[model samples]
Target: MSNVIIIGSGAGGGAAAWRLTSKGLKVQILEAGPSFDPLTDYKQDNSDWETPFPVKEGSQGGYIVAPLQPLTEETQDIRSWSFMNGKYVPGAFRTSFGYHHVRGFGGSSLHFTGEAHRLNPKSMSLQSDYGVGADWPFKYEDLEYYWRIAEKISGVCGPSTEQRSPKNDRVLGTPHPISYASQALAAGARKLGLTVTENSLAVNSTPQDDRADCNYCGGCLRGCQRGDKGSIDVTYLRRAMQTGNLTVTSSTEVLKIITNANRITGVLAAVDGVLKVIEADLVILSAGSIFSPQILLNSESVHSPEGLCNDSDQVGKNLMETLLATSTALHPDKLGSHRGLPVDWISWDFNDPISIPNVIGGCRFSPSMAESDVVGPIAYATRIVDGWGKDHKRNMQEAFGRILSISGIGESLPNSKTFVDLASETNSHGLPLPRINSYIDEMATDRLRFMMTTCRNILAAAGCAAPIEEFSSIDAFSSTHIFGTCRMGNVTEECVVNSYGQSFRWPNLYIADASVFPSSGGGESPGLTVQALAIRSADHILRNKGVQ
Candidate 1:
């Protein structure tokens, strides 16, 4: 039996595995998807210039082909393209909200935009400070060291600590070069009295951690071909593998957690085609917010008839997602919109400030098309530009580098109405599909409207001609940052896991993912927090359990 069995090889699982292996623990990771090596698997030669305006494949508006079978007959839906995509399972749900996640060795890290930002201290203590959302059991100071450790391991690049908010001050690397479009946006935001700063990214600006420096290819979303992006496969997982104490089993799906009385004994999984039982002294579920709850809820036994480690019945409640709004502006002169990293600039001045009325959480502003190619540009132009034929082609050509977009990523509070539960139907794997129901409350809607207005004003201030408002409200399917399904708290009545990510019902079982987040921190990306918390969880396990 392995010392620890980690389910999922994403940011959380990878980080925990790395830390545990470094501490001389034997770790086994089971991944539901195939292994991905960026060096060989990344499509470097495929450029959007070759095929402009390709047919939309998914509900999230992405064109890149994923390496998985198409949706099963039972899951097909034209309106809900998420079900048709290989990346996600099509479970029946009532709300427009869906998840954008990848099932692979590196998990969603493979397609992350690389924007890495820390949550404000105030955001961490939301309930204590603002009377909304659950307060994190631990303070930000407790995780600051782990955050720095995560930054070093991921090779994150960002502005100096002094330049950023005092709430987040531990810097590990230098920031990437700002694009012309970002500079213009920053200048425009400054005119509107909003502070714009360089965004911290997982992509390398200078060669470090044995990874090559970013060459400014502007294809971060498709996958970083040059090894500059810090996906888990290349960073934590690679290091963990090198330690010789870790074994990663890809293309293996975990069906349920096997429990012996009150303790978790192992995991029952489908390896290749046959069912296999892998025993472990400890089990860490990092299958993400949507699937982690699904696995736990499926693990029914005589000792725990409801589910393993779900005595509180809080395993799949409080599903939270980032509320996003986007606006496009046509610059009078070409500003080279599609250059450098996708999200080079970020402004947090408007995010959940105490003075802003009806604002319970913050919002972040970033350049929307830094990583876009010709196809993306053309598709976006079709929405903003007029008529077809020669005029359309001419306008598209002219708008390629002249148009720029700014997006607002806002924080949403976890409400009782939004949650993840078992659907009536079963998936291809013969397991109950996850049913997600998410709704934007009046306060969240008002926050989105305010964020959109701020984006428009910034674009206009940036000297853009006729800044057009494109989209608003939370795109339930578009958010890659999902959290709060299996939250951490001091009491079992409110949370599934404790502050250290250990299950209250089953002590040996831990959760190292966004699912453990008690409150979704501000508008910043949750990648950094996920990794930091995982590292912290690993430390807790080592300190309590010791080397087996």
Candidate 2:
């Protein structure tokens, strides 16, 4: 039997494979999508590229990938996403809406903005802070060392002051100077009694670990052609391959987990529609939030008829996504903003309720590098810009240097209703398709509105002529940051994975993906948190022989 078989070669699996193989263990990684050569597959000019239809287009049969944003339902290669209200609705047959990510070697992190911030201590104690959501089995301190490890491995360079733990005391490289726009926004926010800090991002600011610094090109959403971004393919996966103990099988879809007497034994996969099975002593499911749970739900055996390691019925519950929206403001004078950092200034006060009662959210205001093709022209033409060619150019010329673009990211509390399960409809291979039943509670929506209003006020305070807020509909949920389809908890009955990320029902099975996040780490970007937890879980598995 193989020593380890890791599903998905994303952040979690890539980190695990790096750590495990470095410890002199054999590891095989299975990815459901084709291998993407960054230079070959990515096109910087999106205008020439084939993009998926807009969500308002009401069609489901196309797929597209943006380097920064997570994949939406409109980007699906096939109309296969199932939305769950009562019965599952197929993607092509009906307009089943969802914010599900796609299959890839690096997973959703491939398209994520390189902002990497650790979770606040309060996030680890959700039950204690809000009287809602379960607390994490482990504390931030438990993963502090691993956080640093992941940081060094990924070559993340940011302000050392942003790190909450002492173990993260050492600064890896020179901090990127805060942009002029960020400095000005911070000044304005301070007037409102809100403190804005330089954001902790994962992009390399200086040369470290053989990786180059960011060119400040600001095309992060289209994939980094510069090689400065610290994605898994550049970091862990690269190191894992160096060890020669890790084998990566791209374009291989995992169909089921082969188990015997409640113990994981092997994995069944389909590579280009050819069946392949490999026996393993240990299995780590790091297929991501939605896909991870879908895998568990699809894997059925004599011992687990419902799904593998799903005796608790909590495999696909407590779904949560961070609330997000953009706000636009017209500045009095040209700030020359969009030339610097991606997300430079952020409000820590808005992430929690210490500042605002009964409301948990976070707000960040910055100059938006508006997309010229998709959102910007559409937004300008639909509302503000009245005329077509020359008049539109004149209006865009006026707006281009004067626009102050802002964005707000909020958290959604754990609610079982916002979950993903298998739809009744099956895929082309006769497997049940994934279904999303996600909906934000009133608290989350209210918090979103509050953040948007706060953004408008902040812009106004910053000397904007006028600021407008854009509201999102309930149907649009997938701006990346989806969590809790396979949560961790104190008890076997309430959660799918234990504190150590081991399956309660299956002894040799484990999960290292974002799906195991207990309460979604509500505030800040969760890239560091995911890496820290994966490193710690990997260390635990290696030491304790796979149990907590």
Candidate 3:
């Protein structure tokens, strides 16, 4: 049998490994971080007060609070807290964007919110329909079946009757019960001529894949201890390992992709401070948008001095950092924000490709509970409350169950100016760190403004008493949906990989992550799409290479 090495065990790598191994191919997965088991690592039944909050080391050696404050107990897990977390060299638009990703056995999938949304067909054909962004090498119809398979594998649940796109035919599992926050948003959306639909989530509603149903603990980001959330680690990766054809090596960092002529021969990796070479006929780079390209760039050789698949210098050029806009308002009625999933509803009114102008994407608005515990007191003491003592206490009491929030997740287009390159600095393993340079363009700014306005109106219609408050611009820390460093296209000059995610320069190397996305769909979560594409890539590999 032909041996395959898949780097990173997130949604993309896990899905690809599952598909390949199920077909009898031997697969080896190398993860840069330690293995994370939610059963043991997750803090079950622990409140924010019980968990130890993250504290960064000060320059003077004392401990200080981390800049990115997490109000949940999951932050207690180092694996979940460091999800997509990496260092970057400062460049143009450095201040505008920040990179946040998790590194571990499951990658960012371990800590994701589990929203599985399919891209609108129009978004797949961006150039033909919207006259912006590069069109996908293949249409959505080609991957529709894979999307269905991905949803099935992940056990996605959503409203069966609510149709967001005509192209989406995959039947979701049992729908989650509508929360008060969702109901309030839906009522407000209806008044404003918008439609609010049940979000397709990977979290279980009625129990599938041997996982328990969601208990509505509102602690999804903290890592689900009950296995209700369908992170690839608990789902596809577990299944793949059970097949006996898959082997996972955790805490092993791939330093370089060893190449012979134009074919990938093996990977040079550092495992527990020891360097070793693992042989493989095929290599799938699913190390995510940032590190995936970094690996390729670091794999320079005599035959490929620029990089393994950089004949056209398209390996790490176009980067799309998903834009996020948020709004907060105080509702007059008590909308229990601590009861259900962190994000329980979605509004697709702005996702329409044809109806909106300069709006090629959509946004999702959900109730926010970020300031629930210690942070809540801090928020009232600093900003929300007008006065001290009784005023602060009264404001806290009034806004406890009355505050509602919305986030507008907007689609971002590829810009040549934004990209990931090799930084002068190197990691502990001596591999160069990824230098990210990105900035929000006018189109993204306009879309964010529109989404913020729309979200404010929705909150107003939902009976919010206070004026909507818009928070800061989208940054790397706030935005986790990173796409398009190694984009796929019909031609190698314009993209890094082909439609099957195979590099034109090196046929044995494939990519199966958001890095292969030609265009970021209008506000749709990339988790499902990444898994779908990974499944398709596995099929392509099987068809072309066949079982040895």
C-alpha lDDT of all candidate models, in order: 0.76, 0.67, 0.73
Q: Which lDDT tens digits does candidate 3 get at residues 1-548?
A: 24899999998999999999999999999887776566556665544422322221210111111122222232111111111122221222223334555677677777777889888777777777768778898876788899889999998998765455664455888878877765876788789987667788999998789889999876667677788999998889989988999999887888899988868999998886689998889999998888899899999999899987888988778878767655566777767654677677787766655545655655555544441221234443444445568766777777665657676777788766678888777777766777776655667666766766776777888888644344434323345788998989887688899999998878899999999898887788899999999999999999997553
Tens digits of per-residue lDDT for model 1 on 478-526? 4578898899999889899999999997899999999998877668888
Candidate with maximal TM-score: 1
Clash pairs detected, candidate 2: 63-75, 67-111, 68-111, 68-221, 79-92, 99-478, 350-361
Candidate 3 local distance difference test against the native: 0.73
Candidate 1 off by > 4 Å: 48-97, 162-169, 352-355, 370-386, 467-469, 474-477
In model 1, the worst 10-residue window by lDDT is: 57-66
Error of 2 at 93 (Å): 19
The numbered model that scores best in lDDT is 1
TM-score of 3: 0.88
Candidate 3 segments whose C-alpha is farther than 4 A from its true place: 49-97, 358-390, 467-469, 474-477
Which pairs clash inside model 3? 74-222, 83-101, 83-102, 84-101, 84-102, 85-101, 98-476, 361-522
TM-score of 1: 0.89
